[model samples]
Target: MYNSNYYIPDLVEIQRQGFFNLLEKGIVEEISKRNPITCFEKQIEIFFYPEYYRLTKPFYSIQQAIFYKKSYVSKLYVPVQITDRKTKRVFLKWMLLAHFPLMTNRGHFLLNGSARVIINQLVRSPGIYFRENMHEIYSNKWSEKPSTSFRRFYADIICLKGTWLRIECDKDFSMWAKMKKGPKIPLLWFLLGMGLSEKYILNSVHKPMNLLESFTKEIEKNQRAKTFKELKYPYVSTSKKAWEQIQKLFKLKKTLRKSSSKNTFETKKSSIVSSSFTFFIQKRTEEKYNKNNETKSKKRIKNVQKGDPKQNSEKKIGSQLEAHELGRKWFSNKFMNPRTYDLGKQGRWSINKKLGLTIPIEQTTLTALDVLMATDSLMKIEDGFLEIDDIDHLKNKRVRTAGEALQEILSVGLIRLEKSIRLKLNGNTKQTFIQKNSFFNFHALISTRPMNGAFREFFGTHPLSQFMDQINPLAEITHKRRLSSLGPGGVSRDTATLAIRGIHPSHYGRICPIETPEGKNTGLVNSITTYAKISVQGFLESPFHKVYKGQVQKTLGVFFLAPDKEEHFQTATPDLRLTSLGFLPKNPIPVRIGKRFVRMRSHKLALMGVSPLQMISVATSFIPFLEHDDANRALMGSNMQRQAVPLIRPERPFIGTGLEARVVSDSGHAVLSKTSGYVIYSSGSKIYLYTF
Candidate 1:
């Protein structure tokens, strides 16, 4: 421990109300100050931007590798460095200003995707993982049930125990936290009503019980602790032989080695610039090999309609019925005959009167909202809904439900899952669980140390391990050039720019509910719902996709979860996959048209436009696209609207272990029950009526 003379307050209440300003100033200053190799501010985009869009979840974009040391500076970017260490004194030393040149917008690069490699590696770096600590935090903030969307950390470091580096690979940054700040820079986030957080605020308001206060007592009960098990708080117990033994075993030392050599910084910075072109770091090369066995997975999406990716930019998609005519008029390569569909331009006001609406209804979405409108008026749809976990079909794995089934399946190979468990098969015996052979299951170190004393239930081990061994996705943003120099960074129009998977604005729409029929006016008339839209004429199937200013996390139907594998250094990985069951109706609706497609409304999530899945979820429910540091739960609390419940609340069923959806209210932001159109694949199935 350092001399007691210099006391920097154990917890520097980070109390400077002008927080956004402070952050803005700090970020701008940092980026500008570290120009050149240490570029600070960047647009901070994901890999590529899709032309079409929707909102099953924020389009997936890996954090291409980002490299910067203390010295290099000068670039247009907002630099924010967050490092956790044992001492406040050494924290700043580890900060790095990252510069990402590519995002999800422009799509793939010939060379190995830089961001993907870096993010994965950083999070997976080996070190003493504070797995238990990260899981403890997750549990306190989120439920144990495998959430469609959840947060896990990659890595973190602690100074104690001889300059220890504790990477809690289990904790993933939360998009809920990231989306809070009004649309500003990509990473900049606002802790709206910082005191209103479920993890801290609510817990702190009623009674002031911090982590240390509650757990201190039990940590002492078992005095024969291990090296890492030193009690984090003062415990109420008499000093005894056991205590002596624990002390003898854990002679914690604050490791304060000389600052990492300046050369180390230089090497990393050089690597940053060198990385832009092509990096052959053994570190990088070997890592890719580890997952060489992994294959690119594509889901067997049924109702998915192929897109024509070569339409002219001037012609807005879904604008005219003769879109096919336009295709022939424009591109020599013809695509979807605009006659059948103008790629996601349905649900619009129509001069004709076949669809049965006064004006025209918005058919711009493929969501539950669309489902509510799309299902034949005569069909009876249920009022209540179930959670649909976005599952990785190839990886036949079930999410962690609020039960012992997941663990049982993991350990014993399967659990009892019967269709009529509640009736014929002795409800208890009917539950069936089967395990597959392909899940990348690993035992995590974080799961070993139990932070919450009694809550460490029997099946806690696996969760704890999953929390620790989760892989870290290392993403690198390679500037357009392999080694583009500083003085000049300009982009040419149509010269694809790098951006994360984000949603294109809903197809330029005059109204929503373009497809849904109007009812007795709530004082509003001559209007239809503006369906979630997309311009799918040319850019339909881009790797990444998203919509902008989409509804907040209204229905948490989809999730963008990032896993980490490193120890002590809680960074996030970039395996951004969408997880949520699309249709979880209590009364299973059989699909009429396609096996892959469902009975829901269909929206084409074109390149720029997001997937209908995304829009519908965001419009009515929650899709906390990004990740956050502290607000470690499903969403940032304010992401959901009360009215969004209907869309987010409906039932559903997916082909996997039974995992239902749950609803959560977010009192953080202002939202309303507004209807929008989405592109969904329509089908036939048993339907229930939940009419107003």
Candidate 2:
């Protein structure tokens, strides 16, 4: 019944596109964002703005690579332009970046003569996730572990590239900020260290006067303790110490300067005049214009005098402010620096979408505003004004495609390359040698080993990497489409909790619930549903028919929606009374809208029609009368079908699933005639045909 216009998405499209994207634009984008590499001196800036890139013919064919035990790779060359800041000249050169591995038509890579597939990694999406923590405490006298419990709320601002920020609230309603495994800092102290004023912090809090007065009492009481260890604010003895601690947390360079207060006015004035105030008159000569001009000049010189108590007090204040500014910069760099922290477009979008923020997506780092707003949201969550995220929900998780995986590997390689380039830039003394021979020596500076090693490490040792299943077409397709939650950024088997390993309602249509393995990988690994596809945001979505006034019309069109999106509408099963026009449900039908179950009139519902085989994967869907069999048996049947060997005398099943033709056609086993012909001679292994 399938027509040319009736589309069935290519099962292996994700893998194919992931590799092609890496070849076409992934490398360029990664390098472009990290463009204008700077050395420690900051005098020379090297730019890797790729004009364009192409995949040249592979050095060896796939067959040859497999036979010779060699990698099937294509040389990647990019035209890099280096702008000499000192010389004010730009030089363009074509450099061999890497010999990137090539993917075959079967959506696999030949890495060191072995066929491997990068399994899609399912990880928690980068965003602000609010969670409530419950701590159970027991008294020693009770002789048991669970005597009492306390509850607290926290929010995590997770990043794609940088350190994660965790905001926690204590029993006293005081907040704390912790950066990934670091000691926690009082939120008020953190805000102050980030350059926010007391007034601003007080205004942002609900009870300003109360919080300040309580904090003041605690500080006063703790000040009397013999040692700093007795103080509640262990890390921060003073506001200045808070700033210093913030600086230390980020490992920023020491920017606080010591000003010599003992220098005489003449010494200070002379140094200031020679080094800075060149515009001021050196001599009180007769060349002056008027008395007003001379008076103004004299006043300016007096302001520069060191012993002027006003100037001295001002310098102290200026120095403190300078240190504070440096503290703020160091703090901001932890979340805002592109080199240190990057939220990425997806992360930025998730944050904006969840928080209802209008942050530009291109600004792919958390701003102070983003943090402040997220903190406010966390406060609201504590008060039950907002909901905590379901960590296992598909909406909160995203797929890491092969392209993204490769991008991360390339990023690591680039970092290594940057370090080497910096070392060379620092060592070379002759400036002319840098411009002339440096370009030629650039070939040596660029190493394919790092990238190649990274690739090998990923494809060889990674948990998500697996040898392609060549048992059958279904097995191959399933292997490529497999999504795992056990890779680098995912949870480990030992630490994976029952809640995370259990099947979630969100997996209804997007993931095949019956196809998971029987043991440790039971729910950690899953397959995409027959009618499911990954969205642009890496969310898994399944196609559904839209219904208008309880009738599914062709004009209503097909809507592909993720689990989160489906929650907004009431969806009905496809087995509901179907007519020539569409499904027409009689009487009140059971539908799920949001988290509640409700019975509503068919005409009043914004009905969504599920596909017949939408809830199961392709291999599982091939079983006839699957609805009548036990799920365990069905799972076994599905798995075993893929391992079935093709028989020489093959015959179509008398009673089979409607997908039999499709399976046989797509299996790449049986040969078919291209044009109308008659078999002149037929044998067991040979057939001669007479064409039209």
Candidate 3:
């Protein structure tokens, strides 16, 4: 019977939070003491008594929370925020609760606990439940790759009312959740849950059918009471054999714990004394961290330049969260697939390889294309002007032995037709035309069927286009941007100018200088700021830059970037600081910008709104229609006609996708056909030999 009663669920939720707080506190102490890095060697907790992981809790009142089932536990998860203890403490308190942790093991304790060894083995096995996890949460703010931990952890977790919550290093949260007579929802809580499901269940890790009993047995077996029945340390009094057994047990622990257990306590008083001493040590460690933070803030006032505004701006640059994860292969497959990719990127790569250049979207391909486009269609073209069927002459042939090429190129695609009339004027006609308009431009001779499909989809008139549809991300870019000072400054003679330069427009002069006991601190100022935006058809890159865009019909990836350049407010947590991009000898190089910003593409004719997938369609449709400027052309063939192909970068780069491309000049330009409902490339570089 589900208890519509007291707070068992709340207690369970709160207990998890409390445990996280304690764990973080412990980690902070470890850092403060300059302890080596530590991590939890997790174990599948075994319930010794009630046959449930939840039953391991020593508190008798836990029964109050188990209304769902006294004997049944569908599943349990150990949602570890694989982050530093400090971050785990400050930002992720809510995460510890809401979901379930089969057990919360301390990283340091795992170094010696036998619990650590067994847990590692269990994780490798499929017997336990580990489901939809908030993977890869970074405690340090910046994370690169899909972290095994979770961030925005609060979004997925749900806590019942009346829960007792605890954070890392926190003793416990006894705050009354009794909602006072007030508005229906607290503004903060309401906002947090806004646009969210009315109710969200935990991303439950389903217990395996065969291993459910085994996992349950393990958790039930390992449940230890709050009081570990005092096993005499060393058990020396028993015999040499007893000592050997104790030594063996110690040996089984993680290296750190194995070394730590060298000393055995002889009495209860010693144990009590050790616990008390550990608490004080922990307290002292906390104080040290606080003092360090204070020192850092103070140092900023001292080290900043006496009076350099630009340098001041540099100092004003605060910390941010630029945690980009390692590239996902699926994301890369969007553009690259040498065997099955658009030759666009492959051509560029080939060029790069030939040039011995490491540029992402090889520049050589673009160069070759430019040259081809620049040349007149006099030589490469075989006829005076090419029609739809003429351009279809070339295509990928399934040549078992290079003899079946005709079957491939002659496939039914865009058809040829006459839409315009071209007249040849001789004496009488020339006289009439010359008298009427003095030009021979009125009569069109030929026409062609209209183009459609991915072409329309590319030109952006098609439905079910790859990007035009909405793709809600699992997590949003959290708005945590804060205005803070990171760089240290010293008192400058020209303090006024220095402070002005140091002020970032974000703060709106909220920061100012004060004549402190040590020196003069930079003061803030007030000034209205605006970004001069250009309505462009292009892609958005980082916070400050935009790439070229073709006519866009769809939105790509998580960030919605337009070909039109615009700068909105960058959103992030106020606590996080901005990090500059780091360059490495090899790429895809590790890079970072504002957390809210992503690099996108913009083309001359199209933009990012037209999905990258649609690009090929556009290029294919208008391949014959596009004319090469006289200046750049390298795609020229012996017939004096150019080919159609835009340059591209590798499918996946070190940082992001969408690299530069080159356009080759050809006789044909691709466009929509009025008669036909498909895209066709009309070649202009048709070859015609003049008989003089």
| Number of the top-ranking candidate, with lDDT as the measure | 2
TM-score of each: 0.16, 0.81, 0.13
> What is the C-alpha local distance difference test score of each model?
0.21, 0.69, 0.21
Which candidate has the highest TM-score of all?
2
User: What tens digits encode model 2's per-residue C-alpha lDDT throughout 1-692?
Assistant: 22233356666778877777776777888778667776666766777756486668998898899999999888877777766677576767777777777778767889778888889999998888999998776677657676778787888988888898887776657677788665565565456555565556555654332222323334455558655446554323323333333334222212212244323432332232121111111111111322457775455345644335563343332333454555566677776678898887888988898878899999997776676666677777777788888888888999888878888888887777777777777777426345454553465456677667777777787777788787766787778878899978898988889898887877877888778777787778888877777776788887777777878765756788877788888877655666777657578887768667788777766656565677788888878788899999987887787787757676776766666555545444457677778899989798889996
How much is the lDDT of residue 550 in candidate 1? 21
Q: What is the lDDT for 669 in model 3?
A: 19
RMSD of each: 35.6, 12.1, 38.4
Q: Point out the worst 10-residue segment of candidate 1 by lDDT.
A: 117-126
Model 2, 71: alpha-carbon shift in Å? Answer: 2.0
The residue-level lDDT of candidate 2 at 264 comes to 40
Per-residue alpha-carbon lDDT of model 1 for 1-692, expressed as tens digits?
Answer: 11222111111011111122223332332223222221122211111111111122212233322222111111122222222121221111111112211212222211122211110000111111111222433335557753344334322221111122211111232111111222111010011111112233212222222111212223353455543224221111222332343233222211113364534533343222222111112212222333563431111111111222331221122432243233233222211122222212222221112124443233321121111122211111111121111111101111111111211221221011111111221322211211153211111101212212112232233321112111110001111101100111112223322220111121111111111112322111111111211111111111122212221121332222211101111111112223253222233222212113233212221112122222222222232332332332322232222122334344442331111111111211222234444424434543233334
Tens-digit lDDT track for model 3 on 1-692? 11121111110121133234423332232122211112232111111111111213322122332432222111211122212232222111111111111222111011111111000000010000101213354556665654454311000111111111111100111011112232121111121122111112011112111111221222232342222222121111112232233333333322424545434322322333223222222322333444679975344334432443543443322321110011112112322233222223333443343334455652211222221111111111212232111110101000010011111111111111111111121112323422243322222211112211212222132111112101111000000001111111212334445523342222211111111012242232111111111111111121122222222121222232322122233222111121333111221222223223343222222211112111111112122322232211211220121121224532322432121111111101122123533323335554333332
